[model samples]
Target: MKRYAIIVAGGKGERMSSNLPKQFIQLRGIPLLMHTIKVFYDYDSLIQLIIVLPANQISLWKKLCNEHNFTIPHEIVQGGETRFASVKNGLVAIKEKCIIAVHDGVRPLVNRQTLENCFSTAEHYGTAVPVYAIVDSLRKTENNTNFAVERNQYCIVQTPQVFQSSILKIAYNQTYEERFTDDATVVESLGIELNLVEGNRDNIKVTTPPDLKIAEVLLSEREAIIS
Candidate 1:
């Protein structure tokens, strides 16, 4: 089946304290979003890439691509007011039934193995969501009281949330709701159970300045391994 990735990168960078969107910020010597796109391209040259950006930022993104000489062919779609809307916009651009991976463009460190696993699992199960086990203590706050909970009961959800295109398309047809935080949530609302897969710890969504530093370190470590 054909593979497609809808990379949602509509951040305005207010958290990163930068004028540019977080995805446009330089990770090492390249834009973070470029690193994400290149990795998926490297994974499978046949995989169709669709980038979703804020309507006003599309021109800036194009200019950045020209300046960087980044010529990997991909379609750019305008994002919507909310992430749910943004994803729905992306789903509209897909006309064929295939495997689709909805990913955060800021997550530049999604390893090849994780990508392969998600797609392969989704192909079989109709939906796959990458998650990492929570290793820290957890708590539940109610009113002014706090109670301890089992950390193992919760998992950290990561993206490249892959699903059959038809399932995702059908899921997006529901009226937008505030609780639809992620693609998995949207699909789950349809009574579809999600298949979970292991996610690499390095697969982080870069949002703040500290996240940028962590990504730089992670990239350097990976390069060291390659060298």
Candidate 2:
């Protein structure tokens, strides 16, 4: 079956306090986004990879590709103003009916097993979202007051959210809304139940300086194991 990944990376790195977008920032001497793309390719070389980037950053991305001698083939699409719009724009490039995995470009640590599981589950169930069990205490804040809630009732959603291409296309046809935080939410808006798959806690999105440092440590640990 044909496979594709839409890696959304339009953030401006405001949280990272960097001139370059967080995706373009170096992690273990390689661009964070490149590591993300590589993992998908490593899982299935035949999978088509499409990266959604801010309109202004496309040129810089290409330059980085050349500078890094990154030759893995992938398509680049300009992102829209909102993440919902950006994902919709990425969907424009997909033309076949197959498994499509929508992932965060900064989340480069998703393991091979997790990718395979998501795709396999999505292939059978039409939609699958990776989630980690919430271990922290839960709280509800109301009018400056907080109340305890059941942590077991909630899970931390992560990506490589996979779905059948046709299902995803149908979900994206609806008008964009501010409340649509993730692709799963959009699909749920259509009354479709999403399949949940286990995700790794290590699959962190590099959004801040601290996240970068954490990723560096993780990468170093992985390399140590390999060598």
Top candidate, metric TM-score: 1
Clashing pairs in 2: none
**What does the lDDT read for residue 56 in candidate 2?**
95
- Collision count of model 2: 0
Model 1 bad stretches (over 4 Å): none
Residue pairs with clashing backbones, model 1? none
For residues 145-208, what per-residue lDDT tens digits would candidate 1 score against the true structure?
A: 9999999889999999999998999999999988999999999999999999998989999999
User: Listing every candidate in turn, what is its Cα RMSD in Å to the true structure after a full C-alpha superposition?
Assistant: 0.7, 0.9
TM-score of each: 0.98, 0.98
Q: State the local distance difference test value for candidate 1.
A: 0.95
Q: Report the alpha-carbon TM-score of model 1 versus the true structure.
A: 0.98
Per-prediction tally of clashes: 0, 0
